[model samples]
Target: MNHRHLGRSGLMVSEIAYGNWLTHGSQVEKEAALACVRAALEEGITTFDTADVYAATRAEEVLGEALAGERRAGLEICTKVYWPTGPGPNDRGLSRKHVFESIHGSLRRLRTDYVDLYQAHRYDYATPLEETMLAFADLVRQGKALYVGVSEWRAEQIEAAAPLARELKIPFVSNQPQYSMLWRVIEDQVIPASERAGLGQIVWSPIAQGVLTGKYRTGQPLPVGSRAAHEDGARFIAKFLTDDLLGRVQQLQPIAQEAGLTMAQLAIAWVLQNRSVSAAIVGATRPEQVRENVKAAGVKLDDGLMRRIDEVLGEAVVRDPARTASPEKRP
Candidate 1:
């Protein structure tokens, strides 16, 4: 495993990190999630990422249960805030009041004293940036969090954060964004801004939520018990899983084959190929998935392979959220 400093924080993070997103409190059983966590650690992946909104917050509880006592000391646990938890008006966002309250719940759920990196899950237009930055600084001062970050924020948002952190003297170490072979939106804005702000990038869904993994091929019915099978929030995935795009993705399979790598490995390797990225976060429902995804760390994408992938994707298929409809209704 390779390591990189998390921006200016100077904390060395593995090039591949484990994230509990759709799988932790939804698809994978507790024993399986625990085993996957162990597998990541054994492979030298020290950072664990989770969000407060994942599976309605049960993901944190499961991770906490799995990493209780001295076992918890072996890893760096990271979690995020934002997204509504309930009916209360104050239930979410990056307000100082909420940031202070949310971390307490997160700490209680994670069964840990402090998070290695506590991120604002998204940009909170409602809260003042100063309030959020100051709240994060307080968390560090109180020893509730070691460092602070943001996720899925636009480039300008990262730029906006730097001055606030500098004014408050708080360390803004990283930003987690979605970047993959199929999705290069970060290259447009987020990547450059993070670089300017000295915020190390950690990309989530580096496989584009398994689309680039060659799992959802053209003309195939959605796989049973797969994320494509997720009826609740995967309708957007179905929209872009078009025959034309799958054909394009399949055309690039030879590139991975010629390079002696799996499509998943190739996709992840491409994301980490950027020196600006501190890590690429992988979501695994099974322990075996962790084993498979981690191999991407050192696969290395050469210029010829990159050009071939671009030849297949062309300009890359960009999506408009407005074009997608609601997810499949639960039975």
Candidate 2:
């Protein structure tokens, strides 16, 4: 519930950011989502992270509608632009046309003049970087966006955007990458790159999309109507949720037990232990989940606990998984 500066940018955001990924309109209904958002605000969470592709853009509209009931100045809103929205060739990417069109769509959906942060959801290999950055820069220039950021970008890609933003006088702020006990690729590349560029880091799914939550045990079926059970990308995750992964998760049970916290809480606290991590985005289907997640913010782990975590899952960390035959962007 505490506030933290987002990367090197001047804008301050809640350390615990509410993100709507697969939860909107699917696992969570509008009433429940609104309750969660309200609970987040009451818990001191001020930033909300959403994306253009989340639930096919319905998530932003849902979040916007939920937040609209409250005062507009009460929250720091963030939404990403990228991903194919329609069949047209120009439906996606960071092109000027897409950026302009996307924001208007997001604005109309969110019912706001501007979002606190507007992020390029991913690296647009086809769109010229200049066109993309300048378009984002113009958003800030016009006060339609308070800050610009990128998500799940490679080290070199972010490094390139930083200088370009500097020359254009764009206030590029942070990177939102998937960071959790199960995944540490960002540490191998993105962390050092971000530090060098003075960009703050905000990580998503610090619980590894609920893997670290310790809710699914070995041989137990995926919970009925869970996000992983419903979403398409989640089907890929289902394959990885094996007895082996569950066994590893169980290993950390003792570590979290010693800290008097749940595995999910311990995992999220671990992500925040790094000074470079400005915030960790956590989402929930209900208000109780919000309360459960917020407890991690109060549980400070020691070096011994960290080493124990590393020992339990050391084999999972790879130097560069992106170099493999299958390059996974974000999960």
Candidate 3:
């Protein structure tokens, strides 16, 4: 797999990162998850992304076990904070106490001394930004985390925190967001602001929650056992399953065929076409899916093809800058 530097920092990550967001501890069996991780490693993927809150924290443990004997120095393992990992009030948000407490729990679960990148899963409306940054700074000093980043944060929130992170001397390097052929919300403001602040994007859902895979045909029964059919994944992908959007997605079949790519590969390559995107995180239940996704790592799409994609996905694309947001109140 191809590797790229995350933001302006020297830390490099695989172009297609293997992430276990929904599959590891919840959807797929333990043995299946391990096989997928093995497939990723065999395909030369060195970057793995997970979060402490994923599958109520079992994803990290599964990943840790799957990667147990690998050469640690050669891999870039990243995880996030700022979701409710427990029932206690102190278990959520980015407050100093929570950040410190979360990292320790993450470390024990992941079986690592330090993570390559530690990210804020979302902007915490309930906590002061100073408290959050200070906590991250301490983690850097303590050598528990190498770099700091945020997920699903708006442009203004990133702009506001940039200087504070700089003042604290922490390597604020990346922003993880949901980006796909249909979701262009981050392109308008977030990308520009992140570029200005020296942060790169490690995008998730490059396939639009499997909708771009062309497996869900318009007016067809929700493909058996597909993400849309699963209880845990249905809600996130529900918005994109509209007939209009699905038809627009189907229009890309010819485009993918012409490009000698699967619809999934085409979708992934589309996101990597952006220079600001350092990596695309892909989750899978099966090993073949991991192999298929890694092929999009170094694939390049030309300007004309990109324009054609834009033309086909015309009104289905969501580019509203205001859509790049976090909850006003912490969940």
Candidate 4:
């Protein structure tokens, strides 16, 4: 796998990262999940991204077990904070208490002394930004986290935090946003702001929750055992379930064929076309899915193919910068 520097940081991550978002503990069986992790390792995927909130934190444990025998130095494990992990008030957000406490839990579960990257799952409006940055700074100094990042944070929020991160000497290196052919919300503002702040994007949902994969066909019932068929997974994917979107997605079939790539690989390569994107995170329920998507790692789409994608997805794309929003309040 090709590696890229995460933002301006010296850290190098696999261009195709394995992420356990909805798959590990809840969607797929343990054996399948382990096989998928193994597949990623075999494919040279060095980075693994997860969150404290995913599958009630069981995903991290599953990933930890899968990577137990590997050389830790060769891996980049990333987990996030700022989601409610318990009933208590201190269980969530990017407050100093939660940030510190969450890192310990994450480390214990991941079976690693330190994560390569510790990200804020979402910007915490309730907590002071300084408190969050200071907590991250402390984690870096304490050797519990090597780098810091944020996910789905707006441009203004990133601009607000960059100076403080610099002041605190925290290595804020990445922004994990949802960027896909159908979702260009990050392109207009987040990318520009992050480029200025020296942050690269580790984008999730690059296939639009599997929409761009063309598996969800127009006028067809939800595919059996697909993400949309699963209750927990359906929530994030419902927005792209409409007939109109599926029709637009189908228009990419010719583009994928001309490029000699699968719809999934084409969608992934589309996101990596942006120089600001350091890596594209992919999750899999089966090992073969892991093998297929990684082909996009070093592949580049030509200008004509990219234009065809834009022409096919025109008007169906969501590009408004204002739509790159965070939660109004802590969940």
Backbone clash total, candidate 4: 0
lDDT of 4: 0.93
What ranges in model 3 sit over 4 Å off? none
159-242 per-residue lDDT for model 1 (tens digits): 989998888887788998777777666776677788888889888878877888788876778777778888654963664587
C-alpha root-mean-square deviation, each candidate: 4.0, 2.6, 1.0, 1.0
lDDT of 2 by residue, 163-254 (tens): 99889997888998877777777887788888888788889978877878777788777787665676654863563477777788888898
Best by lDDT: 3
lDDT, model 1: 0.82
TM-score of each: 0.93, 0.94, 0.99, 0.98
Q: Write the per-residue lDDT of candidate 4 for residues 216-326, one digit (tens) a residue.
A: 987778899999999998998998888888998898898899999999999999899899999999999999999999999889899988988888888889999988858
For model 1, the stretches where C-alpha displacement exceeds 4 angstroms are 69-73, 319-331
lDDT tens digits, residue span 237-285, model 3: 9989889888988999999999999999999999999999999999999
Judged by TM-score relative to the true structure, which candidate is superior, 2 or 3?
3
Reference-based lDDT, residue 45, model 1: 83
Q: Rate the local accuracy (lDDT) of all candidates.
A: 0.82, 0.82, 0.94, 0.93
Question: In angstroms, what RMSD does candidate 3 have relative to the true structure?
Answer: 1.0
